[model samples]
Target chain A: MTLYERLGGEPAFQAAVDDFYRRMLTDERVSRFFDNVDMDGQIAKQKAFLTYVTGGPAAYTGKDMRKAHEHLWSKGLGDEHVDVVIEHLGATLIDLGAKAEDVAEVAELAESVRKDVLGR
Target chain B: MNPDRTARPAEPSSAIHLKGRTIPLAAGESVLEGLERAGIEAPSGCRAGTCCKCMLQGEDPPAMSQRSLRPTLRAQGFFLACQAYPIGTLELSSGEAPEPIDTVIQSVEAVAPDVARILLRPEDSFAFRPGQYLDVLHPSGALRSYSIASLPSDQVLELHVRRIANGLVSSWIHEQNEGQRVQIRGPFGQCFHVADDEQKRLLLVGAGTGLAPLLGIARDALEQGHKGSIKLVHGGLQPDRLYMRPQLSELAETWPNLEVEHCVLREATEQEHEGPLDQVAIRLAGSLENTRAFLCGDAEIVRLLQRSLFLAGISSAEMFADPFSPASP
Candidate 1:
């Protein structure tokens, strides 16, 4: 089995992300980040992203991390945002029923992107 | 030509065409150097041969300049599209290493606490066998490697990753968001799957993060209707250390051949068995019973299993193992 298969490919990850962002949209820690954002486009990008990140065959051809969140840096996003992202993502996994190791893999990925996502 | 002014000696030269420009490439110069010298962009990550982002296929298959390119991959036509320069007037194309792909891409999404999944979508017509890995790049230009967790058939590429404490790239992802981008290159490594070998009973063994590849193989098998006995042994230090129990349980319920077992060596510490994993090989001798086994985990565990299994009369040819680099390294 490949990583994509393990992550349950499109359907499973899509569910995870859908549940993930739904929680994130209202998340007090980072809800402001989603204020003006397009959930549809964000979801679309995230679907492609989570698919690729979880070992599926997709590519994320989007903005660079620094440029994407230079605004957040100016707004003072920190490890709190990182924690919020991870926490909500874990909840998303639970909602979608992602496995522990799978969630662990996601958590690892979260940590990898934390610095840039947090804009530190 | 300015020998006295240069600290390093220049080697032989080859001609290359990039973005419609031809430049002289030194014999030892990599495709990356060739492009860099010509002032054209060439994709690369983990120039160390471990990352497959610079993968290319053309008149000549790319060759890994370093032995780090896994053996199964080298047998297939993988070369560090970055490491190799044109030996001839080579037309070049590339896929991510481990697998295969084109272009460079990255966007951030937090998939789990401590795990922010960085998406590396490939360009059109990416080439890769299922189950290869890739290396992710950071704004600071550091490199971290990961595996493609998605099926090879999809247009987009996916990966599953875990965080290393204070890891350069992992830390970056956890803080990033939907539109945020980072450098991504690859589809490196050997395929963990063989085309639905129905005659071969399939046994998947994973330890800790090692389960990533096994997940890929199992999904491929189930989707294809491969009718082999599937038994997965995923052991952690303690039961709580195990992840994916629910998912595995669900899959087992659906597949008659699939049975998942969890083992714990101790209870207090979070560290899972990188495995003495020798126990797996011994366990396999009792259970493998002529089955083809796919093994992935720490190097020590993998090796220990191989030695024990071979002696236990399971033919060495029947065993497939993917060994990970040390955690501290």
Candidate 2:
């Protein structure tokens, strides 16, 4: 089956992301970043990101992530931040209801990219 | 606007709602037409099949192009944009490549400001060990790979998305149809599943949407109720730009063994610090013993983390990652 097919298409993905972030806000460890973030915008961007990447009708034709993030990186995006991002992602999948095998595959992918995301 | 009440679309595959960024391509039009339409200045050494520098991804797979891909690879779905014509909706990911890894888009959604959280699964069922990636099927047919954000054990899949201006997919996503469809495919590269489980602590790093895959790892660790302590470092711009905070906070709230530290590179109206990811790496120095690191996100940030980790005495084998960006042009 196609990846889209395997994911149960758009709804499944939407639900998964919703479940993913809902868990983030209350997590004492990483919720600080979202202390005053806009709730609706967060939902829209999250959904748009998923819709665009997963081949749903949506397209993420916004600013490049690097440059958009350049401002933040310039401020601070160290190994610690990256770790929090990764851990949250894992929890998201579980909440969104991903299989354990799928979750494991995601963790493995994160480790390989540490240098690029948090390295010099 | 009435939703679900709006008639369910018929022939979703054939009728694609054009976003503002779409380029109109006519017959005999080169695959480059879509690039030009999206205003992406693709780097093309040979617009023909020779140099292959122009080799960008197309709107969708089954898109045939020249160069970059061998016939066998093409048979598997890789294509050269310059040599190919526009088929349907063209997607360009990774400036050059075979389709990066074999993949097909699973779903799409816009969860927050300028961020689209995509949940993708590989099309080919090609085995990825974990912590690895398949190039994201960028609309212009570019192979932009992202780490698998969700873990293998988790039933659902996930990807973090923070918008990029002028970025074909990012911009289009920031402005368009909430339910539109896209095309993505892959399960490329390797992974970082720790078989030994000997390490007592797991360190994961992510910046912005880079946290997509790390969510997979932490969730799994928490599920097994593994005794190892999990420390996560997450960073982003202003609080409005904080992605995945809800989920991370909840986990930290409930789990005693998991600790996630949150930082911001951008305060509401001001920028601060050199870079949080690097900052985390600095603090992690010498404390790297018996810890496995999984990192993903924007390329520059990942590179910074990798170097720091190695210098901190973290073994190359113990560290794993999938760089999210590299300007090919």
Candidate 1 lDDT for residue A17: 60
- Stretches of candidate 1 off by over 4 Å are A1-120, B1-125, B153-156, B268-277, B284-287, B326-329
True contacts kept of each: 0.00, 0.00
**TM-score for the B chain of model 2:** 0.57
lDDT of 1 by residue, A1-120 (tens): 655576555546645665666566556778777654433346655655565555565544324555667777767788878788787776766566567788788789767777666555
Clash count of each predicted structure = 91, 201
Please give, for residues B57-87, the per-residue lDDT of candidate 2 as tens digits. Answer: 3345543353333322343344655667644
Per-residue CA lDDT of model 2 for A43-109, tens digit only, reads 4455544433333443333343333244455546667776765677667656655567765666665
Comparing only chain B with the true structure, the TM-scores of all models are 0.61, 0.57
After superposition, the stretches of candidate 2 with alpha carbons farther than 4 Å from their true spots are A1-120, B1-112, B120-130, B138-140, B152-156, B173-181, B266-276, B281-286, B327-329
TM-score of chain A of 2: 0.61
**Lowest-sum lDDT 10-residue window in model 1 chain B:** B95-104
lDDT of 1 at B29: 81
